[model samples]
Target chain A: MSPRDLAIKDLKTHDLTMREAARASSGARVDLLLIAEMVRPGSRVLDIGSGDGELLELLATTRGCDARGIELSREGVNAGVARGLAVIQGDADIDLADYPDNAFDYVILSQTIQATRRPKWVLEQMLRVGSRAIVSFPNFGFWRMRLDLLVNGKMPSTENLPYRWHDTPNIHFCTIRDFVDLVDEVGAGIERAVALDASGHPVRFNLPWAVWNLLGEQAVFLLSRKG
Target chain B: MSDSDTTSGEIRAFEPARGEADHPHSAVLRFGADMPLQLDAGGVLTPFQIAYQTYGTLNAARSNAILICHALSGDQHVANVHPVTGKPGWWETLVGPGKPIDTDRYFVIGTNVVGGCMGSTGPSSLNPATGAPYGLDLPILTIRDMVRAQAMLVDHLGIERLLAVVGGSMGGMQVLQWAASYPERVFAAFPIATAARHSAQNIAFHEVGRQAIMADPEWRAGRYLADASSPRRGLAVARMAAHITYMSDSSLHRKFGRRLQDREGRTFSFDADFQVESYLRYQGEAFVDRFDANSYLYMTRAMDYFDLAADYGGVLANAFKATKTRFCLVSFTSDWLFTTADSRNIVHALNAAGAPVSFAEIESDKGHDAFLLDEPEFFAITRGFIDAAARAVGVN
Candidate 1:
């Protein structure tokens, strides 16, 4: 059989529209945009777990930033390459630290900090290899999540916290405050911060700490070398 | 179905029937059905055929040729109609006209590795001597064996030297091997998102996948091929397990995250309630239908055994000693599987060996699967490298 036929068949059988697949999480691209904005034009950017190179392409097109991505899925990589993006198939846990120090202007780790085994170590490596970094993760301390856990007595499973107890890849779930404390402990200086609400709107128009954990549900941070 | 040689000895007949059916113009070519593959323990494989595919026209000089090697589960169909799944080639992004590899400018060749079941000689091929599939009787193969088989095919086409050789993952392993074993034969090498040796953790992952495939009840002691029953569930499970290792933890969070699949409420059962679970299940299910289970075992084993430095007196540079083949080693920042450190290791070795090499660790969020994506940085790098190499070799 021809590959075109197979792709068509697979598309028909397993075709989930972008909105359906992304679901309510489509707003996360806002976080991606925030990360891109952190980078200056001509700065080299590395998005460790780039999905389809969307953010990297955005950076390149919008800011003329040079971006490189590493993805693990053949289909995702193929999609990125189809869009004329450059992506390599690989795993981040085993591959990220191999990069030399100060190789990039900004190393963005958006929304994936919770799933890593060694987020602190990964962060340290990112700081070591790049002049600046962008780290974002869902705020497990959101009132809804805390209320869900307090009221229901189980691991919260909502739009942002959808995984069940057994199968969830969120190995290191943390709240906005917890991550802030982590950045301090690691001695990485915070340059700027933004926390978006569930509706994808910005929270804490002025002071970040006041509305970070209390009002805004999701947390996004920009960090740099402390010294 | 046959053509006769005229006085000029160049009698061309009707447009040769090409593709799937048993014909001369088929992309896949089968051989060694008569000989049994002798295993390490003296076990024997009766017969087998290897599947392969070719793209672009072979020029009169045949020197303007490039060979593409596929990763695990990839078949000979690099940029053509896949026979089983009937898909439109896997690397169409890099191999089409006007693309980086540029099929219009280079006669591209791709083929199934020795242990693959697509069309190349593999455990699934029939043993002509016994009229039975080779099964476990096929000799265990290493990266060198695959390269050797490919070398034979290149010779058959009357090509002296290749303009360039490219691949990623396991395919990159083959590219490295080609440069090491036949330095005089390749002009340029692109080994993306791959490593010189499998890490201990990666070996553990492969072991887990192998165990998964072997544990399936349908495996039936490797005789499942004859019974028309494959260890599909096991293979699916194995694929699902391995698929997780292919992405950055960041990618999973960005993609499935803690999100639920379909319904708003979690059913709270062991069923696929989360989007991640459903996604994994889909990956596994789709994989089994298009791939042969035995081929998985062989391919994974081949990946596990790839140790280029070990073969060259414990010095990775020794493998590339005195070779003029220009090398471009690319790594993604997020690809933990073969890390940028891995590429640096290759670069260091090439530097030590005095080989002309360039290394780039393109920043990307897509994790390890960055080379196949649409990163302009990667495209520019590839286009630059290929253009430079083409000029170096006087190809275009």
Candidate 2:
């Protein structure tokens, strides 16, 4: 049984709320121990906005990993198939360009790549189904969200940017050096980054990388594939 | 099962009645009958005693052991003091110290299983080579002889490996028989609400509570504690038919369905005209004032011969083939006697035994006693599956 155990057995069958289905489909709140140590224990994940599976039940409980999410929210794929997990809801910018490539050993995408309208064709269909992907977000050059949009210019309510820039869906806001120059303009290679800060913690990595490359509030990357 | 003991010279000799002195958090651990729990009918159970309670401090690398397992007439008092009804350890809601099984970070342990009578050893002790009591000579026990007497109490506490092994009903059948009988001696396994098998309507509601404790007559055959004759009304009608399978006919239609028990009308004949029959007659007269009617018929036939895929060959992922031991398996959508299709058949036999399983069902109207209550979404799916199996077994 593999399409990654039939996509985690259709994500155990979808009941939703990994925190509000990963904040109504990736607005964030996952970190389940750095996604169970970047999905290793028995690898083969894929997630990409999998809500209510809480990062596929924290990579099937701390990396005995064998996930399979996808999600757009059918109530977060029926609460991640009532906790038997193995999601699928669909529409990761046109159903993750129909799978089949590396097939997955990572893929993730937390906080839904700023509510994609095609964030680089859903990061090129999460780098064509996996050999590592990850991503995360919410940086937008943080320093208190660029001092609340350069002092009182609106849009940046805090507590991990709680909406209201005219009903915010956060149309792709970037940062950590514009997402490391969009993963070096699509070639892909980072292999780990992290960040966090604002009450979420993490940050330290021997400072002076220009004040955490402009006030890190939340980032996470991890990429792969290029070389 | 016949051997009445017949008031052997007017019985009543085993004592221990002080007062106000059973509360070092909770204690009652008499090893008694010189530690004899060897029985599978070849019989040899000298005297008996096992009312336990322990929490924290076993570590100097005794790999922070943990074992809770208590259900049909639970005992050992896991997180603290419960010396016979002084109350306070029926899994004091997911066990103490910052909960989620933290007892200040592990070394827990809880006894009372070999056909329980609060303390272990069972059939109401005493039989040192038959000087009396081993009612039907103890013997019969099975959740793998209660995990081979909790692996002989984790080899009397030298503890090799066990950072986790929790339980829920029949203490999740001894945490799925300690991850299918010592899969590398259990690293983590939760097993709430339970069911690796035990249906046929929960062994026909445990054969109507072991035929209402062998139809009482102060249950003489199993020697009703030799002669003070204690089948407390057929063990309070077998704890009121196993407390109506621990609730959820919509929690007895939202706690006490047919209402009226404190005088509303129906001075009605057979008495208790409702209020869930005076709350199942106060949960079967506070469960026969703290259990034992042949240790609730040998702990409901060791949770009716628990299944763990009928001991491997029938494949519940071949009892977790080639294990790494990480499973979670919870279920509650009003627990229809261990439902959600028995935790999706133990997550499809731990995904057809490739192992490494995790599952949840939650929702809850608190049936199958929602793992014993206050469920913050079943405590955030058990703190997100033990903080992702304690960050994948690094365990800090």
Candidate 3:
């Protein structure tokens, strides 16, 4: 695969929408399955940056949920529609504000949050449209990412962050701690959290936030607005 | 052998210039005064007929039937050779034996709308009472009335639910009407290059076309048939003007580029100097032969009065509330007539109504006419959406 495809693939293991190329590959993606688990069966769902609608299809068929998506590229939107899914061409930064509040039961932003220009605004919009928001991202503070940056004194690039420093689509890279802080600042609370190691397995079940932030290469969270 | 059967005194069979009464390629279903059609214009049409053509075979389950609606000037000959012009079907690029809308798999039915001048009942059809053409006396038709007429035909064919309804432009309006009027009967709708309501600019253009036809002395207040005259020039000019909106500036530039028509130098006269001018004249002349002046007036008026949202208490979403039909709307970048923004507005309303909908604004410079051309991306979307909807409805 090309570097761009590699970056998107690396991003997809956590974000169901970014897994454009990996959408056709064998078994269910671990992170997408994880996000799907947090969603209540038969609930309405809105998947942001839903590239080609692989996860939306999974949600609709497996959970019997009314699933829809907002994608940025027309190519992705058309492809998703071809699969007989309700996906429209829209941007995460702009179009979310147009949706009515509480329209969906769950609003999901998978591996794609890191690529957004305003993660905080997008999180708030997702929360506004849905009662619950599920987000997953690659943890920038992972041991390997940290070691590579600290020792090489260069921008860290790994399996999770495959793009070179210049061409990376990730504009707002955030560690698990950084994301948690943003969630709190946005007046939301994490209802459930799972940190995954490099191989996509849950890491250090009983460990503290700091330990999980360092060891976990990626993370998924279920969030809700504060009462 | 003559298409003049519909014009003869005391004639019962009404057909277009290119359609002969004995042609086996199409069929017409007649509904007498007992089975009257309710019109949106607070009038009723009796003793009407719907002309249609069927392609492929109907499956035993009756679930494989697809209805393909035609645009303003199109007729029932969707995938067959035109009996008049001897040209391939207007949508020859999309619907054929092995095309995206595969005739080998699905039974496709194309209908000449009620207000159309084809073999269908329209202003051109002879009035049974007067023994003369209906002309302006025929009750004004709307998109909904056309759909109701189609519903009767579907009932006549013994199909309770259609597998899908597809069209572009004016036909797209009919598709929207189908989804809104009888949501349960339509499994899927593919409306391309259309808007929920006619734009003001479109109304203005239609007005120009109407005025041109009415201005002609030959038109004789839409009683040209009684006067034994045809408003050929007036109708041709109207067609010439409307045809400009169907193509893009870039396409026009590329196709003609201010080039002279069959001459190296200007003639210094009004005789078709430019290639574009020559092309538009040919289009106008060709249209006049196949279309009726009075039918053109009613068709444009119906389009101008169409406002889907107005009927649903001022909310477009209300028109599609709880609709189970799957929808796929396609638009082209260069289509300024009915733009991508128009398609988006419909998509937004569908989303608000919780309808399963997909929208694609294909990249093309072919303007509004792109939907009728060989667009591969559009073909793929049509094939994919139909195939998927087919599976959902267990058509196979």
Candidate 4:
């Protein structure tokens, strides 16, 4: 079996103690694991575009956090709700404004920033509603994507960004550098950042922002509003 | 389980009735002088009776009881066969054994409101003070008064708190009233396709229906029952007009369109040429058979007077201040009568009051009747909300 399949199999067999330890340490995708580590135990969380509520479920079961989620698809909301998580069917672009300021400790938009109509406004709203926001997205400026465009003269489609241009939901795709510039423009500070390779493992630490942007297949950033 | 297992002290087993008119599953509980229902219209309703039906079994702790409020024309016939029409219950789509308001697990109760045409005490019920029907003499009832009567019924059933109060349309209005008036008594509330107050357009339509009923020569100023006569034509017209409001334009067009009724082409006369007209006539005729004109007026008026925020100094959030009851508000996109904005307004107020709330706007073309239809999304959301609330109340 593949390593991903093996990790999932191990997670299923482990009891609560082992499951909690595996979740707190590392088990699944590196970005999600990193996001889980940044969240404090027992804090309130709101996961926007929380497809199937995997992160919300993890936070609730492992960290004992009060987790809520807003998903765009009815099926995802139904699945999340059936698992006893407080998830509602709503659009991130429209429903985010309804939440009160500072309502959650952490607001997460994992792997969904590029699909938003107004990514900057959504990030700003996330910062307004949460003390800290965590965002993850596929890096469009990866070296392989750059090379594929240069050699083949076409939009690159990799495992992380696997959709064709016509059917892709990732409108307004941005690189890590572009996202950093947006964070600066929105008056938010990046508290921490992680660049994950193609195999869902973080790249070497202490790399400059430019090198990380070019090499990272995907990126996760922990952001907070600048006073 | 057998019938005996389903029977409890609060609910009797369903025994076959002697006559066709009697509801085998219904129980009529009377509130005499000792328990007078104080109305919002400054009148006391004494010696009144509430007709209700129970399904499933109420556990020993009674934390599994769910109270369902009926809409304007709905009665206590929620999940069983309707006695009068001999058809399935109104909410059978969502209240059967394995449905959203699952009768297999939780005990479900549906009550006829105070001012309803059903077995409940209303304008048709003879007043104890006089040897005649109350008619107009029956004090104009409000939504709060109906909820108050239900609370009394709940008290009589020995249930201190309801696991959830649920309903749609005017029924939903009663659910909100239950949450607002007896916040501590409701563990959860699901108010679907209803507004905090009746919109002016709704009141206008209701006024038109009321005018139609009163204009009939046989009405006799709401005393047709005493005169041994009925305003059947006027009531049917009123029903026909109101039925159009219950559906969306697309639904009507899809169901009837401009198709000729029982013919390839129209006769060109003023007869029921279109299928829509024939359908409305059938609805009107069917409605007049089971509904009373005076009771219809009273029910619509009750809905018109429902304004939770106005009662709480015009601030909707004040109505839900410190409420521990979890709420799930639902609205349909095609329900123009009670738009999604109304449910959102309620959600905002509940949020501002620090109440745990969830809202869903289901995409439907069925209009206000969407709540009563077999909408899968609505069913899933309802089941999820009820299951979560049941878990919180320790109902397994």
Candidates 1 and 4 compared by DockQ, better number: 4
List runs of model 4 lying over 4 Å from the truth: A1-30, B1-25
Q: Tens digit of lDDT per residue, candidate 1, span B1-396?
A: 112111111111210001121221235434444543444324543343345566777777666788898888676677776555557788877787888888888888987787776556666666566666566766778877788778866766678999888988899999999999999999888898999998998889888888888899887777776776778889899999888878788988999889888888878789888999999999998887766677788888888888999998988989999998888778888898888888878876875565655556778888866766677777766766676677656776
In candidate 4, residue A187 scores what lDDT? 89
Model 3's CAPRI class?
Answer: medium
| Candidate 3 lDDT over residue span B158-202, tens digit each | 898999999999999999999999999999999999999999999
Write model 4 residue lDDT over B197-313, tens digit each, in one string.
899999999999999999989789988777766788788899999989999999998998899898878697999999999999999888877787888899999998888899999
Q: What share of the true interface contacts does candidate 2 keep?
A: 0.00
lDDT: worst 10-residue window of model 3 chain B: B1-10
Off by over 4 Å in 1: A1-227, B1-26, B32-48
Highest DockQ against the true fold, candidate: 3
lDDT of model number 4: 0.82
- List pairs with backbone clashes in candidate 4: none
- Tell me the interface RMSD of model 1, in angstroms: 8.9
Tens-digit lDDT track for model 2 on A1-227? 21233223323321122333445444435454455555568887878778777777767765677786766654565566456555544567875765656767788888779888878778866876677788888787878878887889977788766888778877887777777777778888775666666765445444543466565687676778775
Native-referenced Cα lDDT, model 1? 0.73
lDDT of every predicted structure (CA atoms): 0.73, 0.68, 0.84, 0.82
Candidates 2 and 4 compared: the better one by TM-score is 4
By summed lDDT, the worst window of 10 consecutive residues in model 2 chain A runs over: A9-18
Separate DockQ for every predicted complex: 0.02, 0.05, 0.55, 0.28
TM-score of chain A of 1: 0.83
